[model samples]
Target: MSQRVRGVISRAKGAPVELTEIVVPDPGPGEAVVAIQACGVCHTDLHYREGGINDDYPFLLGHEAAGVVEQVGPGVTEVAPGDFVVLNWRAVCGQCRACRRGRPWYCFATHNAVQKMTLTDGTELSPALGIGAFAEKTLVAAGQCTKVDPAARPAAVGLLGCGVMAGIGAAVNTGGVTRGDSVAVIGCGGVGDGAIAGAALVGATTIIAVDTSAEKLAIAKRFGATHTVNAAATDVVTEIQKLTGGFGADVVIEAVGRPETYKQAFYARDLAGTVVLVGVPTPDMTIELPLLDVFGRGGALKSSWYGDCLPTRDFPLLTDLYLQGRLDLDAFVTEEIRLDQVEEAFEKMHGGTVLRSVVVF
Candidate 1:
């Protein structure tokens, strides 16, 4: 039987999200239904509402979530009912070339439930990142549900589903910040701070946080940033280079997906150092770097897709770290809001105070 539940939806572009009744169908083969415990409000969700992601209207509006498995359909064996799980958008296909090449993290074909969540009027809804988690329940590919410590707080662990994971992965995985490396992170938001934390966790000798806001800079320190640079007050590349002993940081992570910031990241890294771009850029956004500089800078410039993470591998590990008081995932939960407060959360997103406004069920 289909389940009718209240959910938040973006009916059209640039319009406020509405809480409405939605129909969640029973899990089909390879699918599972999850009862959401908490979902984080992310920038991607805002992008979906503003017609930034695509022309997919009537969009289901949440993705970063943690929940419990409620039911499983035929052929679904990855998760069982009552299992505590974190929902991931990328469910890697084992048969994909990337997986067969021993890099499942770069899986080309991710999985999602074949069934559609719908509005009460029978109109189908596009689940944000293929996990419509704003509702009481959501249907997803069984592989999307990664089991973790059942004792973990849903609000904190859920963040691993997206932004935090992206940031940490940008530093640990993509940037490959090793011990004694000097790292600089641009944009001291959730993602940037996660990079800082990841750098500190791996013993980066010097971690510089660059941001326009003083408050965010201070927060970055808590995440293990040894130094702060006000990009507004100083030239980013110069400041980063000065902080890294006049050479440049060994790794520069750009969390703000803007061309200008990316250019700063490009120049802020030491020769042969990696520059990891974890920021999500709009389709219209483009960068034109001098071909000479590209040739002169003999380093890898990489984009981190979902932090180059394998959910099954990273989520549970991070959850355990959180439970052990090693990773402060709780700090990312600025406040917990109800489902009805999503619109207000979106309004405050740019206010810079809240790291994340999570909907706690």
Candidate 2:
């Protein structure tokens, strides 16, 4: 049998998201149905509505979610009904070349639900990032459900499914920040703050935050930044280097995803230091760095897709840290809103007022 639930939908580019009834089918093979408890409003959702991601109209927005497995299809045993899970986009296929090479985090063949959710008239809805949960319930690939500790609040832990996970993993996994290392994160939004928190969690002694907004910089400090640089008023590269003993940071994370910020991250790192680009940039945007500098840098320039995270590996670990109070996941939740309030939340996001306006079901 199918289930009908209220969900947020963007029927056209630049249109306001509407709370409408969506049809979710029973889980097919290798799929599961999740009863969503909370879903975080992310920039990606806004991008979808703006047609920034693609022309896939009628998008079912919202991917950062935590929920309970309501049902699992045949041949699915990874998670059963009643399991608390953080939904992920990458459901790694073990047979992919990247997985076979023993790096499942780079798995090129990830899975999503074989079936599609639809409107009441049976118009298929394109799920954002293949795992839409801006609704009371959602359907996803069984492997996309990473079971985490249920003790963590849904609004807090659900963030691990998207931007937070990207930021945290970009620092720890891609940037490889370590104890006593100096780290700098640009763009003190949710993702940047997540990177700051990750750097702190891993024992990085010096964590510098760079942002234009004083309010966001203050939030970054609360998330574990040792120093804050107001990017609008200060030269980001100079400030970062000044904070790092004039050698620049050991690892600089470019969370803003613009050419300018990327350039800042490129120049704001110490010699042989890592530069991790975790932010999503638009297609037309381009960066031109001196070829000599590219060779002279002598360190990795890596892009973190979903923080280069393996859901099974990272989600549970993050949850454990949250439950133990070692990580401040709750600090990411600025406010909670209902499903219908998502459009309003998007405006707040545009105004740079809220870190995250989560939808609690």
* Model 1 residue 111 distance off true place after TM-score fit, in angstroms: 1.3
Output the TM-score of candidate 2: 0.99
Model 2 lDDT tens row, 1-361: 9999999999998989999999999999999999999999999999999999999789999999999999999999999999999999999999989999999999999989999999999999999999989988999999999999898899999999999999999999999999999999998999999999999999999999999999999989898999999988989999899899999999999999999999999999999999999988999999899999999988889999888899999999999999999998999999999999999999998799998999999
Candidate 2 clashes between residue pairs 3 or more apart in a chain or in different chains: none
In order, candidate lDDTs are 0.94, 0.94
Report how far off residue 345 is in candidate 1 (Å): 0.3
Question: After superposing candidate 1, which stretches have Cα over 4 Å from the reference?
Answer: none
Going through the candidates in the order shown, the clash numbers are 0, 0
lDDT of 1 at 34: 96
